[model samples]
Target: MKRILVPTDFSEHAEDALKAAAQIAKKNGAEIFLLHLLELPNQMNDAVTNGSSIPEVMLFIKKANEKLQKIKEQPHLQGITISTTVQFEKAFDGILSFNKKNKIDLIVMGSHGSSGIEEILIGSNTEKVVRLSDIPVLVIKKDLDTFNIKNIVFASDFSKEIKKPFLKMIEFAKIFDANLILVMICTPNSFKTTSMGEKTMKNFIADFEVNNYSMHIYNDSNIEKGILNFTNMVGADLIGLCTHGRTGLSHFFNGSISEDLVNHTIKPVITFKI
Candidate 1:
């Protein structure tokens, strides 16, 4: 974890993310890149390009900069290497672009938990980022005075594709020296016998030679519910999972458990793209 990208909308939720990022950065001795996007209208962008000097656009930029500076000066962020960028682009696009250009190791951002009609319409920038980001993304929902992870619930199918992200999850767990509860969710739709589940999980763990971990087969109606139920039952501090980074119609029809967890769960989630 060398570089962390935190995109903010100047909301309380965004501050929660910043505080979490600060803790992680301090732990890893990593730099924090704080980004705020200004989704300016086409006319405003043209005016700025032509040096027309739109007062409102300039004012927005100035205020965003001021806010960013204030956040950097916050007590929690002190002594951390913080870089701020106020960009003229959509939130999701700017975040991905920044990550690629900077080679960010992780993205720690906050979600405001959308649901029902609102989610159907506007969706969430945090969800989009989690769905698309190549690097690991940690989604924080609230303020964590001390971002400690003693137990991590990692839910997966124990499939071959999960190996890549599963390794990334291990690296994250090592940072906290956390105990990993590797779970395979067995819903009725995708039911597997206990013996089969245990054998598969054992095989998966064997490849990595992981330590300080336990395996379990959880049963629920759906994957999201199963993972959440298992995590809550075990009182896990963090939830780690892999996402296929699905989009468009595929994402709509099939949906994503990782993205759903990002939107619905209050627990801090770290998603790795598989």
Candidate 2:
């Protein structure tokens, strides 16, 4: 990979993400783009442009610059070229558009870009970006799994739809040299497929060369529980989910497995966008 993109807002949380991105880029021999989004406070721009309320906008811009400055001056970023950009709009959208126009191979951003009760009410832009971005997103948190990705738990049902995307996942696994735990959860009462059915399924997976892969079928009525049980069993450093664009009620009542995995697993989840 030639370029790595790290989006920031200058918060302590964001700084932590930048640090993780730097180490990953340094190890992978990739250039770094240290980006900051400037959503100017237009509502209060004229109100406090120069008034006694505080130099609100300029103060933020200055802080943003300082964040990038600290990153550039860091000893670890010596050879890695770091570039910065600021855009006046929504944060996630800006980063998404920039990636298409840049050499961005991966994105590293904070999990909770909290701005008060929003953090307690619902997740911030970080969760939204994870749902929308096609690239591999590493959402930083206070856990060793964020930096140490030696073990990967790939949540799959061995579906045929994973054919093309599975190749991409395999590519990542090879690069990271991470162990993949292939968990296939089945309903508790559902009997095993017949010998003939097993033969067909084996033949279906035969070409994937899953010799190193360990598969398990979790017997539980709750699919989410099955996934968590599997994740715990493998002690995953990262959880990989392959999305097929399920939305709305299907996601809610149907127990959107990917979304549930995010909430349940403390380990960083990598949802491979299909």
Q: Each model's TM-score, in the order given?
A: 0.91, 0.77
The sequence of per-residue lDDT tens digits that candidate 2 reaches over residues 1-274 is: 5587888776766777777777677667778888888776677655554564556666876777876787789776787778887655578688888888995777877654222313311446665566666666666654242475677777655556666666766766665667777655555443445453345446546768654565555555766677777788767776676655433101312345534444555555555555
In the range 1-274, model 1's lDDT, one tens digit per residue, is 8899999999887888888888888888899999999999888988988988788998999999999999999988899999999998888899999999999999998766434312421456766777778899997766778899999998888888888888888888888889999898888878889999999888888999677999998899887778878888999999887778775101211345534544456788888887
Candidate 1 runs further than 4 Å off: 113-122, 247-255, 258-264
Error of 2 at 150 (Å): 1.9
Could you give me the TM-score of model 2 versus the true structure?
A: 0.77
Clashing pairs in 2: none
Q: Could you tell me which 10 consecutive residues in candidate 2 have the lowest summed lDDT?
A: 245-254
